[model samples]
Target: MLRLSAQHLHELAQYAGDHGVRVVTENWFALLDRPAEVLHLLEALDGEVGLLLDFGNWTGERKYADLAQIARLAESTHAKANYDADGNLQTADYAHCLKICADAGFQGPHSLIFDSAGDEWTEIAKLRDFVLAAL
Candidate 1:
């Protein structure tokens, strides 16, 4: 399955490139949940496609390390913010993720992601402020 996906992605990337469009994939798919798989796909593509790292995609104890492993390959990022029931930001984790990307020399654009139930603009502003401070 991974091989097949990689082949398809490579072809798609070629097609997109012909139209002057760059192809990028995120680490959100179940098939690409692991760092090795993501790396393999990128290797198969041979720089034809770039990665859009998502902060909230991979979870658990290895999340940070996993993200660090591929941070350098990212063309952009989905800076997804998590919040508690009380609406407090998960500062330590988020900041650490941002720091990892920054340390890896990731200078790409960060697309803020906030999905909590509230005024989206306000939540986005809060997230933006936190990201600014962290970076």
Candidate 2:
């Protein structure tokens, strides 16, 4: 199963490239949740695919360092933000997180992923504006 999965990813990357579509994998799954494994896969793919870095996907110890390492290879980003009912971030620091991304040289377009107890579009717009300012 593991081998098949890797093969499938390679095949998908090849197919996407043949069609002029870029294939990017996210670090959401166990197989890709670590920096070493993610780097291994990226090396194996040899630019056949890119990485989509997600700010909120990794948690626990070393998340910041792991994110910093992954951010260096990011072709795209999911700049997710979590907020309280009052519209303030619960605990995550958007500025610090974005600074890590910037320091790692990630200047790609961002996908504002907002999780809030408010209107979705409104929250998206708000987060988008914030991310725009930060970037």
Candidate 3:
């Protein structure tokens, strides 16, 4: 149960603002796994926070729907991908994921996040290119 209190988040947001940086969070924690929780936090912070939507991060039922609900608030994206034995993306639908972000008007940076064997850079490059082209 990864958690960050609203007060702590507000303090961090203020600190980041003072330093000329924006604070963002990812849905990589149980506390942030739900759309309502994320929205509530953003509202509590007066929308001073940014969200980093991660593809293929949230699993279980209605994954895409949940993602879309959060994507609308996305300031950035973690374009994570899964590759097959032949080094091809197989786990998730990149186009579907990208489309959701696009529909939500997310035009920020797409950071590649893929953990696999073989050439890391090569896999990253492949995902990067795919995301870029998709965007």
Which candidate number has the best TM-score?
1
Q: Which stretches of candidate 1 lie over 4 Å from their true place?
A: none
**Per-residue CA lDDT of candidate 3, range 1-135, in tens?**
223567888889899999999999887657887888888887887877788898867876777899999998898988887667877786357788898999988888888888877788888888877877877
Clashing pairs in 3: none
Candidate 1 residue lDDT tens string, 33-130: 98999999889889998999999999899999999999999999999988888988889989998998999999999999998889999989988888
Query: What is the lDDT ranking, best to worst?
Result: 1, 3, 2
Worst 10 residues of 3 by lDDT: 1-10
Instruction: List all candidate RMSDs to the true structure.
Output: 1.0, 2.0, 2.2
In model 2, state the lDDT of residue 107.
77
Better of 2 and 3 by lDDT: 3
lDDT agreement with native, every candidate:
0.92, 0.80, 0.81
TM-score of each: 0.95, 0.88, 0.88
**Superposed Cα RMSD, model 3:** 2.2
